[model samples]
Target: MIKIALVHHINFNHLSLSFKQRTDYIEKYLEKILDAIIVKTNISICTEDLLLLKVWNPKVYRRLINHPKVNFLFSTHNHAIPLIYPETFTEQMLLGSKVILDLINPKKIQGVGYPSEVDFPPKISFESICKVWEGIILGESRIKISGLEKDEFSPVFTINDAWSKNKIRGHLSRRAFNYRDYLHKYFRDEANSGEMLLGIQDDYKKYAQGSVLLARIDLEVILFNAPIVDGIQQEPPINKFRDLQKYLINHNVDFLKVADLDKTDYKIPEYRISDIAPCSSENIKWNNKSLKRRVENIKFDRSNKLKYGIWLSLQCSDYYCTNFQDLCFSYGDKNKKTIFITKTRIYRDQESGIKLKLLQGKTLDQIKMNDNELEKYMQYFMKSNELLTNYL
Candidate 1:
């Protein structure tokens, strides 16, 4: 079987807006994405959390929960963020996972990536992430084995209708064995079962606003490759995922949930990740290099007091408004920043009520969570425990 997986990277957008505004924005784009996925029959997708699903749209929630192919994977930001406080993060994920288990009804939740692909520091360390997820998780899809973010790093954005092999190494599949990152030797023995799990940072705002994407740029415009809106972008037509699903269907590609990675009966022909993970062009070198350098700088940047290498980029607007602005600015080179994406977001410490607790040198499990604290935290993140109240 030609096995392939698609990860719709779900994250709450317009975070800087009011609670209602955030919910509205998320709901609008979310339904658009869901419309694309749900329209086709038997199309399975792996996604971050269901907090938004449970909060905004009960009809979609019912359809998704009742849908046989839905798989809910944790972004592992504890399903929350904006701190070193395990209390905040843990409460969020613990609660989000609870809702997901009750709704999406996946057999297992083993994968963990960052929400919005932002790895904030002191708050989430690689060790901390592993520890936080170990007890709750079964496997991590791609844990720095390779950055699963190519749609953004690529200077151009495509609907990704087909899989083509390119010569780019590490960043994209250069050879026939082209899964971004996975400890596949431990799991699979087959060689070429298409691409492993392909992740698209699924956000309407990102595509609409031109941050995570910049489409239609000529190679000659290297100096003018505007990551922050200097290049042309392919605005997703309605039902954007249809062509992708149609292509896979026409090619006889079978969709696989991430949970399948843990079981036996691996099905690739020879490639470790996938024989068909498509690679971007040489144009990606400049943009991809900048991101890699940023990762390196963040690795040793002692300025944050927290460990570096937490997969951070000041290119995100969250940096500009957060306390980390100065640090990120210093860490980011003028020429080396990825797309500068920022939106007014409701940051954690900036809120009031239920004094937020900060976890200093603590494991995630050490903190005990209570309903009151979780409820308070949920209000800020999702507004009044909507995941719990609205879902049930």
Candidate 2:
């Protein structure tokens, strides 16, 4: 009875692809999912980059033009906005996406998704962003794979491990998936008990051009077949959606849209930045030392505003994102240069909306950089083990 949802992060390709091949990747890979949207039960396409599809496949783009069942929402630009950039940069990315989304169908689109689901800072979110943009915050699980203890999985929203959960089928054997046993050990204990947003994320084109993607998201399941991890075998993904759909025909795993929430007894929770575990700018490199880090908290002054001007080197994730051990809010001090950071509590801010400003530009870069303030804030993945493997 777990309420599940599937999300596809599209247009994100391998770093070394040629311009022409990039479009081909989508046509060859994403087109299969697009075709499924029409033949299978209805599937909603919420992306951070619609222009990726607009430029890559016009046929699929037209399908979403006015199709009510197949929806469109622009998430922020590809990067994890909140964790890496300043509040101003986050605002710019949101506005840029909003502008492009409006052009597609202003009336149809009214929500936005977070880039990597990074928790928003209290100072920025509670006071300004949500009230200004006035759009719904359409997002998923707040549980970072870097979760320290089994307890970390308790979030108002959820991350549905579709294939991992439906293992009785012919997908991965129970043995192979034990590496992912935390999915059950931590995430599933209360997955079915409440009204929460359930989601699954795509690893930057984990489903490639030649790969198989049976996007049965209407059943809240989107699947990508194997050939992942470079050296791994070419295993086939599960066709569990259809089977699950039939099972859910009379069950209680309700697939409710955001607008319909008010009719139910859903409660909105408030959060302070202190609610989240203190996150380090370090890449996740811990797990063996102990589970003690799971419950550690860092102190942050609500009154101390974020000090901008820190620049992460191009492709510098070494600076921020996952990892819970050695939690420190800022490095150095008033005497030395410091890097500011925050972690979001898993349950709060599930569907909160924010107001925003618009800037003019044909390309996203031009629009984002238009703000002199964002350039200074520049600089933040979804790899869980990458975080939990070493003592970070």
- Candidate 1 residue runs with Cα over 4 Å from true position: 14-25, 38-53, 74-83, 86-93, 106-236, 263-383, 386-392
1-392: candidate 2 lDDT, tens digit per residue:
32322223343322222223334344553454444332212223323234435544567667656565444434443343344444444544444455445546766643433333333322334333443333223222322233323322212322222323211100000111211222222122223211121211121022211121122211111212222233332221222223333334344433433222223233323233333332443224312111112111223332322211011111111122233333222112331322111233111111000000111112223334432322221210112112211211
Give residue 372's error in model 1 in angstroms: 28
**Model 2 regions more than 4 Å off:** 1-7, 14-25, 38-48, 65-67, 125-128, 132-224, 227-247, 250-252, 258-263, 272-278, 281-392
User: What Cα-based lDDT does every candidate model obtain?
Assistant: 0.31, 0.29
Clashes of 2: 12
lDDT score for residue 190 of model 1: 22
lDDT string for model 1 (43-129, tens) is: 212122244445456676566556544454544322233322323443344434444445554554434322322222222332344
C-alpha root-mean-square deviation, each candidate: 16.5, 18.2
- Provide the TM-score for each candidate, comma-separated: 0.40, 0.44
